[model samples]
Target: MDPGTNVLDLSQLRRSCSSCALSELCLPAGIGNDDLERLDTAVRDKRTLDRGGMLYRDGDPFEALYVVRSGSLKTFVLDDSGDVQILGFHLPGEIIGFDALASNQHVSQAEALERSSICELPYARLQQVTSEVPALHRQLMRVISREVIEEHRHLVMMGRQQAQEQLAIFLKSLADRYQRLQRDSTALTLSMSRYDIANYLGLVVETVSRLFSRLEEMGVLEVNRKSVRICRPDLLAELCRSSGVPASKRRDAG
Candidate 1:
């Protein structure tokens, strides 16, 4: 009954899944309150990561899954030439570490794009709780499905689209994600570097820079360094569609 122990417990309770702001967008979505409390117990650790910190490296053991409570992260792998090939950027409320599930080891590295807070759920405990909570299991599948869809979208963009359409699809996808978070969809800050962006989009750095300038001139976007404001979202959407990329299907978490 120590007073300091009681205070620490209260602090942790405030960060529990039931009290988290991203509950609806995260694993707690569509679960009963009782189930949320159970899931919260499974999330054993909440940690802070500084910018450029590596959460996991290629071929590392995957002991737990991480949920981004704040800030952003990028996942990438090294090419045969030892060059970094960017995979994807992860925003707040998204999950990472699924890549390890298939082989029980991570094949890519995840690094923090900024100082961030993350919640960790150990795999064994998560499996135990999900088996007892059908709703939680269903929600987990939905999150994983979204990740698969995004990968397919990226592959299509890289293989078929021109540079302009590729950039358009990337921006439009970010705007959609922002909108889902109930944030301003038209404005976005690029958390990853231009070189990383170029790598992810399969374009050179110069081409990425020139496209930003070209989009600005066309009034489709207003770019100031890493900050971008989609001045004409309609035009941006049109560009995405013009390349024959299928329209994005908005999946509901609930």
Candidate 2:
């Protein structure tokens, strides 16, 4: 948890992370062992962020691209009207600050939604490593491609989906992500608050609360304070497609 501490042992870190649930999505699929080791060396810090902590703010110097080792993060932007628009949520094994790679300043703010750990790879060092490690460059390309795809999905969700439909798709998406981490996909503990969800969904808190009640009453979800269980995933998916709710809205609803 200490930013100053060497929280990861290099040899063990490489071995442990190589088999991590996210490895297939993260590392270069066909990377050689030596390249993997080189990539590991680029990681400079393993820092822990507590709930409500700011990982980095807009205009903060872009130093490193962080990989979520555990827990969840929310990225958002504040408008001139003082309203916060949630951009996206990052889960374990996902990369943060990818947008910064193309610009000198960060495009948005990243904050911890729960106690989280991230591995930081200094940008300059990573660039240097990539120059010498072809596999690393390929891996970086894949990461960027994934980001683009996710962004495209968000844009579609925002433009097309309705509130209830969006919420259903969001729950299913979160459940899929949890399943990847070997967690229970049906039941989830929400680290982000209802107010945050409302802001992200572009709805009032009352609307968000009402949606939860409606879904619960319909036997589609089991809702508790900051916790949820999807009782009918198939039905939820149908709602997402039929209602055309934005994915971000659904994700925030729970």
Candidate 3:
């Protein structure tokens, strides 16, 4: 074996998935160690976005999916009325740009809520790796599926759930996502501001503030500025489960 070839392989080996803290959340459970190297190779670029930076703008040509290696982002669109419509929030271990895969052009803009690192998975390379690795393909599908499910959850929240229920579901969902990344689920910092949350949840800023105050009074949670501590997750869960939207209605909408 050539010594130079051995050295190059060692360099690639050092970039394996085990080095990523969010690997367990991003990759499927059964991926082979060898597949991790393939993934690392497919990740062609690492880009940093400062707070308020746009990852990709509406109508930008999209040739890759970006995974949030660190930081947070919000995907939004400007409606015909020139109003900003919040789509969703992205956290570490979550992948964005899946929407652009269908049309090859982004319909919404992804903006960083804070300074963040992103891993770019070029479409061509991702397809090549997915073709070679069944687990990789499945993992990508699962991530896309979760995004779809989350969208539906948001729709249900807005369409029928009360303001309190909507807030509960949102908080509970955020907690669950953080837990998946091995973070403290009960304690979290809101990267997206209150204004953004209100926009996304279809509530006015004052209404959002009132609802948070109500929840705090209920002793279900504590909120100080952007820091949230879930004092009673059980109570929060109950509120989410009792969302005014019935199961039959959800199924029919689907």
Candidate 3: tens digits of C-alpha lDDT, residues 134-227: 9889989999999999999989888854887888889999999999888999998999989999999999999999988988887888998889
Answer with 1 or 2, whichever has the higher lDDT.
1
Worst 10 residues of 3 by lDDT: 6-15
- Cα-based lDDT at residue 197, candidate 1: 88
- List TM-scores for all candidates, in order: 0.91, 0.84, 0.89
How much lDDT does candidate 1 score?
Answer: 0.87
The positional error of residue 239 in candidate 2, measured at the CA in angstroms, is: 0.7
The TM-score obtained by model 3 is: 0.89
RMSD, model 1, all Cα superposed? 6.3
lDDT of 1 at 17: 90
Q: lDDT tens string, model 2, 156-218?
A: 766654777656656777788888777899898888888787776667888778899988887
Q: Write the per-residue lDDT of candidate 1 for residues 61-163, one digit (tens) a residue.
A: 9899999989999999997899998889999889999999999999999999999889998999999999999888888899999999999998998985589
How far residue 44's Cα lies from its native spot in candidate 3, in Å, is 1.7
